[model samples]
Target: MGGIDNQKKFVLDWMDNHAKELSDWHQVIWHFAEPAFREYKSSAWYVEKLRAEGFEVEAGSGGMPTAFMAMWRNGAGPTVATYVEYDAVPGNCQAATTRQEPRKGLSKYAPGHTDPHSALGMSALGGALAVKAAMERFGIAGTLKIFGEPAEKVRASKPIHAAKGYYDDLDAAVSFHPAYMLPMVNTTIWDTHCGVGYNYIYTFTCDAPQDWIASDKYSPIPQNHLAARAPGANDALIHFYTLNESLRRSMLPFTGLWSFNEAILTAGQATADNLTPQISQIDYMLRTDSIEQAEIISNVMDNNAEAAAKATFCKWKKTWVAKSRPGLANHAMAQATYDNLILVGAPRWDETAISVAQEIQRNLGLAPMEKPFLPATERLTSPQECERLMRKQMPEWQRYLTSDDYPDYTWHCPTVRLIVARPMLSAPQGYTYPDWVANALGGIPATIDPMIQSAGKTIGATLLDLFTRVDVLEAAKVEFEERTGGGVGGSKWMAPLLPKDFKVPHQYRWPEYVTTARGEEWTIPYRDDE
Candidate 1:
């Protein structure tokens, strides 16, 4: 109930002054809505802004085209790091409207921010800028590294950055993700943080269709219906998919919540070719609570790929995409972030925001509530409570669930995972709201600005605390060292899952907006003209 100190006040006031700028930046990214590995415009904008702020910027950091690293320093002090994610999810192109509508001049199935990375990126930027303001005014000494990470939905860039020594020199890290679940609305991860994830692509190739049978000796024409054609890459992909689907149950113990999903990157898609569709690529990403479980499932998948390739007379190769280790908990860092979150308080919605939620409910043909926003978004939830809610649905022995690349930084330095409130609608019993409602709210300034403002202030104050409170930072470091054996090289420490010479799987075709003779349109057209 008391007032905040002058330094924290200064940080909060900085956030207030720049709140509009943050909202506008969020709008820019929401409109861009570029999906994984193709965030050219979003990354360029961040690089330009960081360079203008007097930070040394690296355009392409970690060999990922849309990933970057920027640093601002004030003499010699502790080096703390934070990162931004801008890549939107594919096939979720919802416009900022009460109804289910896509952005103007784009297809309905184009990319949009499902997790609303738009707010996440802008809030972090506002915080970093505010931190810069405090450092300049109070003459604080430290380093701030703002990483531009792309393809976070696929968990792509961070692991690569960590493996390449991007996070090795950090003293601590601050990570922010927009809240998703109800009970975890304004809380950070506790004991069982995100787990291990493995992403790999199986490429099947058919080089010789003629080698299936001695066609030349029996018949002169090998391409006609007179001879049976050899099973090619398409069949290989089908076999791989079906075979994996069949063996999915036997791959691992059905103890914890694990998942295996595949997306066909390139397989006789959008075209019916007479030829043997020479090449096909399918992506598989699975989540498990432990690395040992991940390894078991991955081994089964690898064997399935080989069998499918052999059965279809094709050659198959597995390419590494991403691997994220289970997150390590730092009680000290957690306490620091929660303290700052308390200082900043939860995001409060205005009547205008409530009206917007009601409008969305009406558009969905559902009755609206007097207070349409979910209660959790307006109140704080402690870390312990959040951990309880997170594990309520999991089995007892499972240590982790889902997966996030932020854990990669935890293995290197004391890292804090900050979860802030994002607008979510409350629904009537047995009635569900479409995902577009949340997506639309994320884009509207009235609904999303409060979240951005509070998150920015929390981040600014927390970073300022690390610079000023040596005891807290040291305590976090000690806790981190104790967890990872002795430190980075200590026992029980986990190294980067990626190999030294791992190549990024960027050569495959990914969906993106394109400009042609018609206009700037989705690569796969779904409009009336088609």
Candidate 2:
């Protein structure tokens, strides 16, 4: 609990030797910058890389074309796990430069890594591979598995993996993410863990627009205002979104951080005239502190869709994007990870990293200070303090406060959600920075490598302790069992939110890059001819 062991040292040193390689891969993913459910190049590179490392790779593990699971075992021992998420957010295409601009040769609407999942993926890959090397050199006995999770921004993949029993055999899971906002940076979660989220799509079709009149006895003139064509899909979508917004307060108590947001996947399907705008799609993603709260919000949404469809003479169907469980706390696991984090210490920014931050400030028309990054970004927050700060606004009875699908792993086995600081700048007094600032910082190698390097070292150290220390492993298992009321199949245990036979909604129209006559572009422009 105090100092690093010889075995742990091996993995940390492993980070030192392979740091550049990991950073190089980070840039590779940044350049790929593929959107949710469309990480073709990103996922393929990871698959090939894992195979080259002698992993028994499953290219499409959970029936997702871009998801993968790679495993390597060394004799008989405890099996621990970790994962990589490489999906980017669409419309976040700012380049990794001081000025606001899209990456070269791409449109401003192209997908980009906002969370900079680019570094998140590399951090875990570096950690696991380091453990793999240490396993051989130190004759450590255990199994190591790394999952390639795609479409994380959509909250996809992991729930499917959980239902398919992919996580059923694991003894532990270590989750690493870049520090997005407060208290979570450089700490493990003690309590007040991540909340639950539900994502769904409502599709409306105006198939019977012509039958707006009773028995279709009335004649209808095409493309004429006098003809009273049915209100159509576009009108129905408007009804649902507007109705949902009106009832937003009644859907929940409005006492905690609970809300739903929407995205219009397709509005009029590019229909030029009043061919009744045949179909439309809208996506809703809601997060709450409890499954009960999620259910409360979901019911209102379903009813709203029904009413909206009926009013506009359209029929609709609901498609689930993802249904994720709230994270369960494992004090033993949290403590172990925090101990390792303290050993690694906080991320240290050098002159180069600082200079990049200063450039960003200057571009924003603010005077750059000697230290541009937030102090919290570099300071360590203990697990207890994180919980206290997280619970400050919530009621005493509420147990969770945020949202993520990673919690799905906690139900199956012990999981530790780890975070290392990505470079977050300290703004001038009363001047808030724009999102593009953070996005740009994430992509620049000089600024982000410090956080990436820290994660690799911290993750490797935690995994090594799990493999070699029986006491640490058993303690985690004990806490996990207690939380789940005897673990996996117990009375308090919650099964995967998505059914085992649930189909992934990859058919939805998500923004993606395409190869054109010119070359690969963000999305092809509208065309009349093939």
RMSD (Cα, Å) for all candidates, in order, is 1.6, 2.5
Evaluate model 2: give its TM-score.
Answer: 0.96
Each candidate structure's count of clashing pairs: 0, 1
**Model number with the top TM-score:** 1
Per-residue lDDT of candidate 2, residues 355-424 (tens digit) = 9999988988889889998999888999999888877877877878768789999999999989789999
CA error at residue 175 for candidate 2, angstroms: 0.6
lDDT of 2 at 239: 97
Model 2 segments more than 4 A misplaced? 1-3, 214-226, 252-255, 524-530
Q: Against the hidden reference, what TM-scores do the models get?
A: 0.97, 0.96
Error at 48, model 1, angstroms: 0.4
